[model samples]
Target: MSTGPLNPETSTSLPSPPFVHLKGIPNFRDLGGYKVAGSDLIVRRGYAFRCGEPTSATPEAIETIRGLGINHIFDLRSLPEIQKMQVAGTGPKTVDWPGVTRVFTPVFREESYDPVSLAKRHADYQSEGSEGMVNAYRTILTEGANSYSIILRHILEDARRSKNTAETALIFHCTAGKDRTGVLGALLLSLCGVPDEVVAEEYNLTEAGLGEWTELLVQAVLKQGAASEEGARRMVGARKDSMINTLAMLRDEFGGPENYIVTKCGLTEAEVAEIRHFLVVGE
Candidate 1:
């Protein structure tokens, strides 16, 4: 694995380049590049990434992900989703990269949201529109808090132990890489001191990044008679208002990301501090 920086000149003072594009992988991007609010720090690039399932990743794309030097992968997909990826021969397979450590942290369990139930849920999304998606986000925060807590703790521990090198980098993802991944990404950025607006903006980027696939997903839902065209669009697209409302809900219910992490997610204050300490870096 190459140990050098992907872009040596990139730093907190300068904007990072565009996300590394990997064919067959939707919504793949570094979690870096944002300047932490109220500090001279920035999220160190190449150390963290977020993406959709990689089951269909081309050989070249797989090589590219491998080249990212990721050591830990936190998969937030449901069991059915993971199985679909496995059966379809898409996404990252541990066998493909023996050196990487992959952890299956399904946000929704098999019994709770199996494939048939998930399909029904998607249909519900069609009628519910963005409101449905918002409710889903809430469910993730409330019901999936334990899974998220584990993910956050693992990331904190990895960041703490790693020497801040590419080889120690961590990547996390869900199926769409928007909803579940978005919420976790938002929380992490918020913990690193990024403002809610920036966090929402980052979340919104998924609409553009996954535009083509989003369209296909919406079409699929529509074809299944799960939702109206408008409903399907709302369900598949990543809207800023959805994240904005979710963050507001986070504040109203849990007081903010820190409180949510400590109270709802069961992370300690020290672990939270360690996250900021290890992930945020000064120029």
Candidate 2:
């Protein structure tokens, strides 16, 4: 994996496919193709992607993505997330790409609100919807465990694609690809038998990988009249506490990661067995 901006010509030589970059889309890269769990085979290159709000994708950007043979698009943004961060352009609103599958994974919906906004704007989720936000958070406590199921669905689709020679790649994302996407990444890596430290390291990479961008985000926000350190802090982070908390939540609900998948995520042991059989590179 070349850890740099992918130039169209030089990218062909990359260990994994060159990262698919668009001027407007941030963090669009393959999560597969990394050395993990002692397997020579990694997640198939060009199969999985993590990106920020893609509403800004230009015609060229969409063309590049289409060229990558994306079979499915798993959108992790909440309804409000999409609305708030409206991509610059609009297209035929269809999840079904000509040869792809589209899935919407919303942790929070448009109606939900979190009073705490970034320090810069001093904005709150209040305008979005007060009770909806509270209800959404409560639902997370009670049903947050359900995300595992949604994730499993996407992976199963990936596994199925791998089995069939059809486009066997899937890309998933949330707004920043840090929290929602981060947890899903953690779950998948852990299931592949990657160590917690490795997972943590991968999670932490967000700060380094996105640090410059985070700074730019702060500057952009300030240019928009947001002047708060909290906003800046929020931009440059893989919040340790949030990561730890999510892990704790998983442990508390499911005896282990596997249990979380089978019991909580709606995957039977056999189903998970199928996923492992197809998706994992090595035993």
lDDT of 2 by residue, 18-61 (tens): 34546556656666554556556554455567765555456666
Instruction: Give each model's whole-structure lDDT.
Output: 0.68, 0.53
lDDT of 1 at 274: 78
How many backbone clashes does every candidate have?
6, 2
Supply the global lDDT for candidate 2: 0.53
Q: State the TM-score for model 2.
A: 0.69
lDDT of candidate 2 at residue 276, scale 0 to 100: 59
Candidate 1 residue spans exceeding 4 A from truth: 1-18, 84-96, 111-119, 122-130, 163-167
The local lDDT score (0 to 100) that residue 147 gets in candidate 1 is: 80
